[model samples]
Target: MKKLRKMFVLMGTVTLMVNFCSFNILAEDGIKQVSEVQTINPRSGNVYYKYKIINGKKYKRLWSADKNAWVDPYWTLA
Candidate 1:
């Protein structure tokens, strides 16, 4: 009976370890996917600063393709 109990405990520990390792691998894969999706396209037009009119004011700002958003703190005419 004692040997059977020990065997079960060993099996459970092994199962838990395997599950934890697999979960970590899956999480890493997900992180890689997210990073890849967020990467900016080199050929995209976001690299150059563009002119924008806001509140009757002309400002310049660069777009961030990686973040999929426009940069804040627009550059105003000097």
Candidate 2:
């Protein structure tokens, strides 16, 4: 009976640890700082810099190093 109880306790502890670790990983994944714009796009994995047109349109853009072209702006300075 004592051995069985110990085994159950160990199993419960292992389950709890797994749940805690998974929760922490999910929590971390939810907290991404998109405002911290890097020189590269995280999704496309391309380097970019902030750019914009100063004409009547005044449209913003990003110069992608990999694509070698201007792309629609989706980044914000943080």
Candidate 3:
């Protein structure tokens, strides 16, 4: 049972890493369609634009046109 759990954990981690890498690549290649959309701060619930995903393991990525800056939504909330 313990070995099974360990195997599952390892598999899950590998799967996540692969998915993240693929997403990061697509984001860089601009293959994902990015458009202007109204988004709300998960914490503040404030609306914002220039939304985008930045590739990082520990940080969030967002581009705000109003502020003309990049922000990490995760850090903003948590």
For model 3, how does the per-residue alpha-carbon lDDT over 1-78 read when each residue is reduced to its tens digit? 999999999999999999999999888876666689898766533335332344633433466655566555454321
TM-scores for every predicted model: 0.40, 0.40, 0.38
Top of the candidates by lDDT? 1
Instruction: Give the 10-residue window scoring lowest on summed lDDT in candidate 3.
Output: 44-53
Q: Looking at model 2, which ten-residue stretch has the lowest summed lDDT?
A: 51-60
Q: Is candidate 2 or candidate 3 better by TM-score?
A: 2
Q: Which regions of candidate 3 fall more than 4 Å away from where they truly are?
A: 31-78
Better of 1 and 3 by TM-score: 1
Q: What is the RMSD of candidate 3?
A: 25.7
Candidate 2, position 42, lDDT: 65
Pairwise lDDT winner, candidates 2 and 3: 2
Please write out the lDDT profile of model 1 over residues 1-78, one tens digit for every residue: 999999999999999999999999898876643334476656654455668787887878776766677775657652
